[model samples]
Target chain A: MIKDITLGQYFPGKSFVHKLDPRMKIILLTFFIVFIFAARNFVSLGIMAAAVFAVICISGVSPKMYFKSIKAIIFIVLFTACLNLFYGTGDPLWQWRFLKITQSGINTAIFIAVRIIALVLISAVLTYTTSPTDLTDGIERLLKPLSVFHIQVHEIAMMMTIALRFIPTLLEETDKIMSAQKARGADFESGNFITRLKALIPILVPLFVSAFRRAFDLAMAMESRCYHGGEGRTRMRVLKYSKKDYLALGASCLIFAGVIICSIYLPATVRTGM
Target chain B: MKFIEVKNVVFAYDAAEEGEEPKTVLKDISFEIEKGSFVALLGHNGSGKSTLAKMFNGILEPESGDIVVNGLNTKEESTILDVRKSVGLVLQNPDNQLVASIVEEDVAFGPENLGIPPEQIRQRVDSALKSVDMYEFRAHAPHKLSGGQKQRVAIAGIIAMEPECIVLDEPTAMLDPQGRKEVMDTVIKLNREKKITIILITHYMDEAVQADRVIVLDDGRIIRDGAPKKVFSEVEFLKCHSLDVPQATELAYRLSSSGMKIEGTPLNETECISAVIKALS
Candidate 1:
């Protein structure tokens, strides 16, 4: 029952978007996010939204899945829109004795909601198309330049890779330990706040113990294979920039430039009293 | 040549709290397993079989003795990696040793750590999966596999490393009957076909009966070391050490005690049945 939570999940596909270099996806996603902030007028925001929807369609991942990702942040989106609606003041459109909704307030709410939606959709597209390992590999390659600052990019990547590798393992362990504890009559579903928390102790204790044990074993196993630290380590699947990736990058750059131009040239709206 | 040589090894686990005396786990254990031999270590709980297995790969340093693996001392830090690589350890719990979410990735983990070339790692992963009949589940999430399948994947991980020897510590302890059969079959096949040395640590007497050699551990010492027939022949001695003889061996022992004429000891069900028929005739 706990497996259906698909936030930040990857959906494997053979679409052109899914086949693009993850490094390019990372760059393009960054470009997309920057353009999202650069969107000042409805025309630019609409263009950006259309581009995201197009990418989503090409990736073959359902819009329903994208909305599922957005659902998690729905509360935050609403809260931000409400805050913007109440705080901004200019040309009151509706007035109650002490409350007022102004023209500027309505504009601000719309802008904030649009920005939130754009941000969520663009980020969701990247995650939906890219696998966790590919994303980590892209990050490692992109951050390889940080080695000049001795940031240990390989170690960070390896850590992320291992963490991603162990998520399912640890989840399975948790499930097993939960069942074991349940068989021992350790109730995790009933009782008050403290009682439930206390029940979790048995599960958590074993899970933590097994996690540490696994870490030690894995470290030993890795060291046994002469993993001295990613120095001069070559990956099995080397990242390569192909023509498709170049096209994707070029298209994203054009959209980003258009957004910047629109943000600079778009006229500011002036509100009159209602 | 002896692939693994342990001489006068002693080991203990230090209590976590300060000012506590270290508890001895293995005491003056001595043995040598030759290359390409399948050996089984059998013992009741707390008999120190696991500690001895750990010493084979230098996971635990002997307190006061020597363990030489493939012409390298296990105590030396420099040779530890070599020892471990030479002798891969598959722990008892199938869940703990698996390092990746996908079966293929888990199989690739060992080769990746060894810094094998990507192409070679891929090939090895494929062949290793095929060796354990898990090739079809290459892309499947390992968490979704049954206990037997997961354990097979774990074996494939070690096999991908291309180790000369594999040590399994109670690989079937948590498995059901079918899972146990699957794992045991894989271990035997790896031993026979790949010529990888197998050191299986198990409590099941039936599992030990198939080994080329069986060594019984009791209170941190080797009580019996011989071929399965020789070891099972001493039924009273095994029972005294808190270990059981194979049921067939027990039945044979019972028949012999009752003054029936059975030619030799039986360590397997088929042999015991034949012995019973002979006695009846």
Candidate 2:
């Protein structure tokens, strides 16, 4: 049952978007998430939609993946959209006891639904192109400034890297332990909630024990490799930005300017989005 | 000159009882490894070979006396890091020792720890991967490789550090026959072409036969120390220590005892074959 949880969700490709620097991709995503919510009216929302469309097109990923991401977050999107249906103050389109639907409420519900879907799709595109390891590396690079505030950025990054490295190994180990228990007639399926929870104890205890053992072993291995708290340590694959990153940064900055201009100059009454 | 010097070193495990004496694992052990020499330390279980290997790199310090690694004493705090930098130790399990997910990243791990420049680290990782013939898999995950390949990668990790000496403690014990041969070949290539001091600790007599010198440990003491031919020739002594000689060496030992006229004890198949031919002729 645990086998289906895809940890990385990485879709390997060589599209222009995929080839962009990870730090650049992350910075782009951050701007995207903020500007998306900062959008107040139709003009900025259209611009955000155009940006998402451009990323999707340049990414060369099949549209099926974006839909799958939307499917995964469908419940939250529907719940938020339904909640927005009762929110805006405007003419009632449909009336019920303590529940009246306004025309603006219908518009706001659509806007909220589309916003949630776009958020999921944009983040999905990031994960699909960038590997988990590279994603963590990008995060570490972005968080490098946080070290000035006495945060242990490098340590967190190392921990993240090690955790990512061990996931597959531990999953394989869990599969083995589960099979061994199953062979001895330990029923995992066809049980009540409590019974299923009880059956998990057999699996969880051994998994925890082995995980601890692996941790101890990895700690020793790190010491043998002369790992001393990441002080002055260098990496084989250094993260460096290229021309593509610069181009993406410029394009994103221009889009942000457009978004801000549209939000201010464009009147709220021109409410095509909501 | 000696690449490593151990003089009157003693090590003991902590005593469990308040009044009881500590259980000694290594007692008054003294040895020196010549620079660029291939030496095999042979011992059965509980003979302290692994403990001795750890002490060489300052992983475990001796309880008494002093050991010097490339002019740095293992006893000093500041020098211990230098000693480790100079003398790399590859333990038994490759899986446990590999720190990086990628092959080349793991290879560069040791040099990176030493604070080598990024460019130099790149060059070293490339060369080290090539040395182990694992260059093609540099981008592949370390867990995806076989036991032999992983051990080779581990060796490459040690080699990238440019350590003057490498001490492998039963590196082949967990490998299959083919993996064992793979690692042995890599170790031999490193010793011959690179002229790196190699100290291989194992009970495998075939591996010891390939070494320039074999030092046998029994009950935490050196029972025999000499060339492989000289040491394995004492078949009865080795047998008493619960150790076996290489098959050809034992064949010669058995045949001669059965009234076959073998010239001398042969250390390997080639020597044994020629000796038998000479005797028949």
Candidate 3:
């Protein structure tokens, strides 16, 4: 089903990763991404892979669920790996017309493939663990410093969260509209690209009109609830850093520091010798 | 003192085109809604009832006159938020009104904006959900709920703010039969048990029968204002204005108009049935 797209979807549970504060998970995800990019050798990449696996295991989410995120970026991963295959610097293994694949190209391809997988899985763990509401609150809290610049951080976060909440509703509405048009014998699927684009005009017009009407209604409701601004607003689910959060933070920092040290001191020592 | 005071409040929408006249939606409307009263505002489409409900919460300021809610004039800039705090308004579309995905989180949206303490906000959300019997669905997504349940959660959202009065403008208009009853029961319970004043704007004559006072509007004017039995008894007056009376009241009126001597006008089913039984006896 179209609703079953697993990207950025969360599963509610009380696993160790889910129990961590959203802010902590967000921060850890940032460090995890950096660590993945910093690893240039097999050992450091293996460490990155191990850390992601550990998070997935503790999160109690199926590895298959985490793999679903990769499906979304498979094109980019394949493109990059294919591009790197002909650009390696050492010992050309196959030569074609004006193109060659080297032993070092194969090694670099493997490294990048691991990095991409680790990066996607590490971020998937974040989304899979934290609900969208908590994620928004965490983002608002993290960006509170931007308020000094007079940026409307809370408003932006509120907009994002509302948009997220409406995604499924709007998608469902679109599905219904498509079906209704189909029932009326409106051809949507068999046409050429331009004709297919033309077919969507019926759906887009009503969707836009309804969306504007909903925006007006929502604004009135918000005003009725005494929403002036973020100045005096209080939150029900207050974000806090507990002992587990601190422990998770400490572990992420250790791994980040280890990767940085390894990258600086052992760049060529642990290279994959494929 | 009356909970809400409207003094000849006048409002109009902007003109649609150049040289076109701006349409007046509410004109010279003056009424006082007392504290803890269940008043239903009944009007047909374009009768200005929804426009009047908006004025009560300062969503639309009157062009000429004034509206004071809980002793704060909605005209003053500083008092608008405070006035809104006292007079919470629920709207027609249940889907648009809910901001949070989860039930409890959506309930918390109101008090959170009011700047309540975290612990107190939690308490209010819990109590509000319980009052609406939606406590079990606290963690459930609002989108997944039935239309009636969503409207109930919307009411719970207003209740969390603990407003003295709630103005619901066609809240159950989009709800199914069962959902409408669920919302009406919650509204009545809030009024009777919690003593929260209710200003319900509806076109459903049956729902208006539950109100203590029914105010009828036509052409942006108050055509009738009285108890439900008294107002619904004026069958011709309402019919002329393109409005309806409750089914029982209409039947009773039909029976009376046909030369039968029905002693009393019936506003609901029980009263209608009993009146028929008495006439037979």
Best by DockQ: 3
Which candidate order results from sorting by DockQ in descending order? 3, 2, 1
Q: What is the lDDT of residue A204 in candidate 1?
A: 86
TM-score of each: 0.91, 0.92, 0.95
On TM-score, the stronger of 2 and 3 is 3
Return the top candidate by TM-score: 3
lDDT values for all models: 0.84, 0.86, 0.88
- Give residue B207's lDDT in candidate 1 (0 to 100): 97
Candidate 1: tens digits of C-alpha lDDT, residues B160-270:
889999989899999999999999999999999999999999999999988999999998999889999898888899888889988888888888889888879988888
* Poorest stretch of ten by lDDT in candidate 2 chain B: B93-102
User: Chain A alone, model 1, TM-score?
Assistant: 0.93
lDDT order of candidates, top first: 3, 2, 1
Clash pairs for candidate 2: none
Q: Write the per-residue lDDT of candidate 3 for residues B40-82, one digit (tens) a residue.
A: 9999999999999998989889999989887889989887888
DockQ of each: 0.49, 0.52, 0.84
Q: What digit string (tens of lDDT, one per residue) describes model 3 on residues A1-274? A: 5455542588888999999988888888887887787686777778788888888899998878777789988888888888878878866789988799988787787777778878888888888888888898889999999999999999999998789777777777778887888899989888799999999999898888888898899999999999888988999988789999999988877877777777777765325422
Query: In terms of TM-score, which candidate is stronger, 1 or 2?
Result: 2
Supply candidate 2's per-residue lDDT for A195: 89
